[model samples]
Target chain A: MKVVEIRPPYLIFLGSESRATYAKTGAGLAQWRPELCSGQLRLAADTVDLGLPDLTLEQAAEAGVGSLVIGTAAVGGGIPEDWYPVLREALSRGIDVVAGAHKRLAEVPGLSESAAAGGAQLVDVRVPPAELPVGTGKKRRGKRLLMVGTDCAVGKKYSALCLERDMRAAGMKADFRASGQTGIMIAGCGIPMDAVVSDFLSGAAEILSPDNDDDHWDVIEGQGGLFHPGYSSVSTGLLIGSQPDAFVVCHEAGRERISGWDDFPLPSIEDVIARTVELGVLVNPAIHCVGVCVNTSSLAEDERKSYLAQLEKRLVLPCVDPLIDGAEAIVRGLR
Target chain B: MKVVEIRPPYLIFLGSESRATYAKTGAGLAQWRPELCSGQLRLAADTVDLGLPDLTLEQAAEAGVGSLVIGTAAVGGGIPEDWYPVLREALSRGIDVVAGAHKRLAEVPGLSESAAAGGAQLVDVRVPPAELPVGTGKKRRGKRLLMVGTDCAVGKKYSALCLERDMRAAGMKADFRASGQTGIMIAGCGIPMDAVVSDFLSGAAEILSPDNDDDHWDVIEGQGGLFHPGYSSVSTGLLIGSQPDAFVVCHEAGRERISGWDDFPLPSIEDVIARTVELGVLVNPAIHCVGVCVNTSSLAEDERKSYLAQLEKRLVLPCVDPLIDGAEAIVRGLR
Candidate 1:
């Protein structure tokens, strides 16, 4: 496992992505850490933008961009052949190439030599740290809140980031722990839980959120859902490894099926909460659900408000779209 | 992930091991596939023996041994420096080196060159197959029975093998699906579930026990316990991927705590059954526990019978030592 440290002042690569949904990685970085991002680079004129200045390879290098981060994930996580020339040019200019794609940047033909020639590093964000220990199941000192989802891309990362912000604003000691590529690029470090060996899934999660201050709250970003047939193991491992004192169930407002797994239906917020607690207790005896965070971006304004209100009333927990309504209400429940 | 195929007529290498427990791999191979084993190789005179003819590298080569399989796992699964010379010697003799250790055999300095020079292959059994897909969670065609445990090293592998042998003897279509190194060696081919990436844990399990004939039973070997804080994720993933129609709880008699974790106590048979059903039902709605396999070797002869009888009465399920009493009773319950 490799611990990836991506250089900042990034040039976001959109790679001809027309839809904003597929370009969420670039959007997330632009939304969260605008200062670290120097500009955006797109392969096509009609591609989605992250509101950053458009820059060419030479322009990005001239502007002192330290790395070019692939912001859009392609289907199957492969690097498109068309994007190679730009990446090669960036590397030739001593700009580090950072990617979380399944195909490693260094594995691309001639990429390593090009990187060596320009004295630039090629960072693979998906690789985990080496020699991770198996989960001890020993209780850690810090207070931790993990964001669990009903399916993949159901606002777990967003909710966690929001909680960290609100918790800090509310005068609490907190740190947002990233668990995926986008979040890792935003926070500058994290273990890609999905890429870890099955035996060390929980172990890596334990390393991701090590013992901290007694009063500190580690808002750990979560991964796949417990009911997700394909990835439930990753979810279960992360949940157990995190051993969160409290967790928030993150769900999309209107989605009924698992993101890519159409054969399986999504587990309800209640189901997610119940199962998270049921399995979480194996590691943390006192684990409980703190709130619910729903992604209501697809819902109408009225429907979003009503849906959240109905959910809060039914579950007897704070429910909010962390992006829109803010996470103050959820943070209030943490106390 | 690499699908390892070890050639038979094995020379079991028990490297300076004094404890029979530490040399279980050799013991297992000798017990299950005695005809395939030509001889034993020990570094020390007093080391545990598998009752095979003790042979030197020259004698093993003369006896037509195809592989020198490392049959003892060290503290951290590393090949000891002292054993390197012997391994090199075996490779130099054109005997393939087969190891399931954490440190790859190819990574051992000068071993690859020796193997190549002698036209011998280096087999790393822990590496998984490449391009494994995420689990689809779709029910496959076949009846599968999984061996789950209350903790690590609790006879799950032994129980599964026993069931496979017993079920076959009873004129049932059954195949033992190996998930670990020793079992894989016995079965000839299997995915090392623990070595698979976290996201593909279930996928690998799916590949391990693919869709078979309706009457065929894939008795999948299980890994870590669901109650094991360090390895529950592997257990959960395997359970989901196997989608076993039936499961058998494999437990060691009087083992109160998790094998390596002194802090966490073992879950009871009832607890294991309940939770296995609870989690397993997500992938296998018809999942049920058929019987219990207890490793009662630690108990007295009279005590073992009485203990099993009392447990059978309480749990209302067939309870037997798969090794001592045979898995026939459990096989009867499976029908």
Candidate 2:
């Protein structure tokens, strides 16, 4: 029922360090509800080198893009030096700059002053929670929905955000509570849960959703998968903290193994649902899995259909590819 | 076989915060090998009122205590103000300082210069790993003995350290690998695994116990229980990173639940053994629990006798209260 207003179109800027590992972060902006922003992705290097189609910075400038989004994973180095000229150029043009990288562009020496002088917002998406409390075992009130996935980078945030938007569009009072860098960037407010202290990971979730009546819903974004070797703790913390009343098991069609982990085979969708429900019940025993949110974008049309059909057959719960079918089914299933 | 020559007798300093939650940490040094330190606990405050027996700083000074040990957990506040005067007094005396608190005593205002002037060593127990690598699932060299536990604070480090000592006493090349803050303090090296990034938690463990030949054994300390809601991630990361050839299941005699979680009931000893073995196999399938290290300190003599007898009878593996029987049976069992 509410749409952001007075915000300018975002011109996504992907520098040399933006591809391969971080390509999804850059592509997510234009791909997530394209009409929400001006359709332009500006590249620092030759446009032809990009795996995906994108425009050069000059082309974005020619189109008079209103905002700059640093849409790349920093891969630990945080804000590559090659990115400064384009970032300063964007700030000097009076364009608001938003970034999901661990490094804050605003901290690039004179960039904050440049942003201040140009009257632009300098946003760092992974800013940790200002104040987070240790999780109390006390039960909280809310119709909370969580999106868990079979692997990392499987669009749990996308599904959660989609559900939030659809619920809002249907005249329901709902909010999207982000749990990671990408989700934080999109929501404009959320803690990068992984970067938080080990004890505060779940506490971040509890603070984000808090408590609300059944009539009000909280669409909570999920983190890494439970089977992920490197980042499973973040997932476990989110699962313990959110205590969702119901959850969506998110997965990509035809994915055989956990991404980046060749040893971890993807669990059956049913197993994923069972594990999620089991974790939820630790806090709220009445909790359950309401639906399946499959990302079938990578599969061929026949492959997608067959894969979804197999998943639907296996799971008694309603299963839908949120990207293609929208999350209306999931929103309805939460009831 | 190797007693460190440079380190001198530690005069254990327990601030007012010592007795309540971090009583274990204060007591750890006193108890690790009581004879390793002088029988002196310096009180920061009043004449008596300490939850334990102790000596005054002047008395310790008269005895020529060589170093001061901050024998208390900071509980995240680091060094408390009330304890600073006593700390300054210790530093002024040219006493080498050792601590396991998250806060580094060396960095406390004027303390580093005081230490420098006094020609004393300022040691921070949990001073992170020097460099860490992502777990490559590569085969590593060494006979790793990991001490897993049924719950947190149930003596994983105690057993690991005990095994290390017992192995060395038996004329073997053994090294203790610390995982948590307290363990790091005891061993004088190793990462504070909980403070590590989620992706790097396991990686920290891998780096701490690098490749070594069969002549050497690594007795790695464990952290959090897998069933603990607040800290399971830390436990899981340690388990994966250690990839032990064999493990020892540690537990208190009367603990029936997870430490901070009232809802989480403790699994039976059999279940704990099975789960530890299962997780160990995830890293190296041939891995298993070689013995049990029970902390029967809370039990009466008759109860301890019957409980351990029942455990040893039910499970074929050797089960010993390491403090009582000295972990020699467990060390032999690792073979």
Top-TM-score candidate index: 1
Model 1 Cα lDDT, one tens digit per residue, A1-335: 33457788999999999999899888989988899999999988899989999999899889999999999988999998998888888999999999989888888988998898888988889888788788888888898899999999888898998988899899999998888888999877888899888898888888888889999999999999999889999999999999999999999988999887888888888899899999999888889998999899998998888999899899999999999989999899777
Q: In model 1, what is the error at residue A138, expressed in angstroms?
A: 1.4
Least accurate 10 contiguous residues by lDDT in model 1 chain A? A1-10
Each prediction's DockQ? 0.80, 0.32
Interface RMSD of each: 0.8, 2.4
Model 2 alpha-carbon drift over 4 Å, by segment: A1-69, A72-97, A105-107, A112-122, A168-173, A277-280, B1-69, B72-97, B112-122, B169-173, B313-317
Q: Which 10-residue window in model 2 chain B sums to the lowest lDDT?
A: B1-10
Candidate 1 error regions (>4 Å): A1-3, A14-22, A41-49, A53-66, A74-95, A109-120, B1-3, B14-22, B41-49, B53-66, B74-76, B80-95, B109-120
Chain A TM-score, each candidate: 0.90, 0.78
Model 1: per-residue Cα lDDT at residue B191: 83
Index of the highest-DockQ prediction: 1
Docking class of 2: acceptable
List fnat, each candidate: 0.89, 0.28
